[model samples]
Target: MSQSPIVLTGDRPTGPLHLGHYVGSLRQRVTLQEQYRQFVMIADAQALTDNMGDLSKVRRNVIEVALDYLAVGLDPAKSTLFIQSQLTELAELSFYLLNLVTVARLERNPTVKEEIRLRGMERDIPAGFLTYPVSQTADITAFKAALVPVGADQAPMIEQCNELVRRFNNCVGKEILVEAQALIPDHGRLVGADGGAKMSKSLGNALALSADSAAIAAFVRSMYTDPNHLRVSDPGQVEGNVVFTYLDVFDPDKAAVEELKDHYRRGGLGDTVLKRRLTEHLEALITPIRERRAQFAQDPAEVMNILRQGTERAREAAAATMSEVKAALGLSYWN
Candidate 1:
């Protein structure tokens, strides 16, 4: 019988999961858990590549992110939720995969280059941060994942993974590693409240899943609308409006949102009126998440236990893949 298709995707535990994540990937993961075998990794190790000086922050955020996952309804029974650092085999596989890829190829990766530029790491990028793609290849192949949900911009990372898979298979004379396709969402990329192309915590533009009603209110009030639309009577440009972009994803009342967009385009719809509707729609989603997060936060030990069990199961899977990879490389003299 054919095995079920597996999906491997994760988040860096640098900060709380935000609305950008909710619209972009988290909501999809909750639905996907029922259809496929899923591995939700807490990418603490990957988080470290960029934040090496702040191990304490990473450790703290791991639990914080895991709570966010559980709060968002990722069932542990349906999905394997584990910490990436727990599986030492992934690092070992990464070492082997790195040899299969070249420095030039890594340097040429569009995603990595953009990240370096965005983070202003052009002058001083750590070696670990530079080779993150190879490590990601290891993460994907270790589970033989067939689907990896990524944004349009992350298509380059998926390409890099498939390249490493082909190279490894050809060199080892075995197709042990599987190539994955990117599951692109129909919705366009989410922009930050401040009108940035991306919603990021570093930029202070994201509203966290854990953000309270007051915080959400503050975010809604401060949200960027059409900069040129200084008056309610002015015809606003909806194309680049952050509030409408959010409504397109979060608000279920499509007809109402559409009418609001039309009214704004034609003039007379004020930003305050639009923001009030947005606040109501967003609160409907965030309130429940906050409640669940509060419940999970009460028992941190239970959360750790779930991760511990998941890590053990992940280790077994990673070990099996490593065994096959080592055999392919003729490094299994003892085994």
Candidate 2:
């Protein structure tokens, strides 16, 4: 496979990956692996920015997330899958970039704002949480990445990163850092089974990527459909239906799905039937992914080795960038 041209993307190791991740980004990462210089970081350090006290969870999830990456066909040979904490250069760079960014500016960032609200920390947001965007800027510019795949909600982050890049280059008298473009996925957000706006593990609305067929089917069976569509004979609503939502994503028979929607709207179509189809569709889709995950599960050490090797390569590139950044700032004491 050819290298990923120059893409920097990763997941926070807060928990195991779910179907939402697959639809939102992992599928694209699998496709882009051979096309870009992909750097997939298991962002444990970044997770600490919010979950500071949950070190055990962070520590355990690092390998679990790596397994998910390998299981999803993120070729360690093609994509650099690294543990973010291993690269000290990123921390060093983040500190310098923090000096260039202001607290008020970070507060104004949409992603941070939304996250602060979500965490219900209006009274007491952590300092590390506030500075995460700067650390993220460091993550991208440390490698001089040209592209960062982000969801629509995360566009502000890319803007913030670029803003820092511009300010840094202007202050330092050279454009040593590269401005990254956001590659937003076509399907931005995948709603949860409970009809929640976001599919999240904490909400118990997410189906694990590694979920078993029975587990997936159960989740689908319990999925939230249109609350108003109470009976099979009643005309169902598809415009805001979560069953149809999953169908739109997982169902391959687009014509069949469309037909089902029309039948449901015209009356006589049942939620059970629609849910059964969705369950079948998800089973078909997840079966192969589950099999792949099982295969990778046998070789846990191999997965760790892949992560270690990627970390080495990632550190080398980051170190090179840091050296240049230090020289740019006339801060390199080693000459």
Per-residue lDDT tens digits for candidate 1, residues 245-274, read: 888888888998899999999999899998
- What's the TM-score of each model vs. the native? 0.94, 0.95
Pairs that collide in candidate 1 are none
- For model 2, name the residue pairs that clash: 4-35, 4-36, 4-37, 5-35, 5-36, 5-37
The 0-to-1 C-alpha lDDT of every candidate, in the order given, reads: 0.91, 0.89
Per-model root-mean-square deviation over C-alphas: 1.8, 1.8
How far does residue 115 in candidate 2 sit from its true spot (Å)?
A: 2.3
Considering every candidate listed, which one attains the maximal TM-score? 2
Each prediction's total of clashing residue pairs, residues at least 3 apart in sequence or on different chains, is 0, 6
Which ten residues in a row are the worst by lDDT in model 1? 1-10
Candidate 2, run of 10 with poorest lDDT: 1-10
Please give the lDDT score for candidate 1. Answer: 0.91
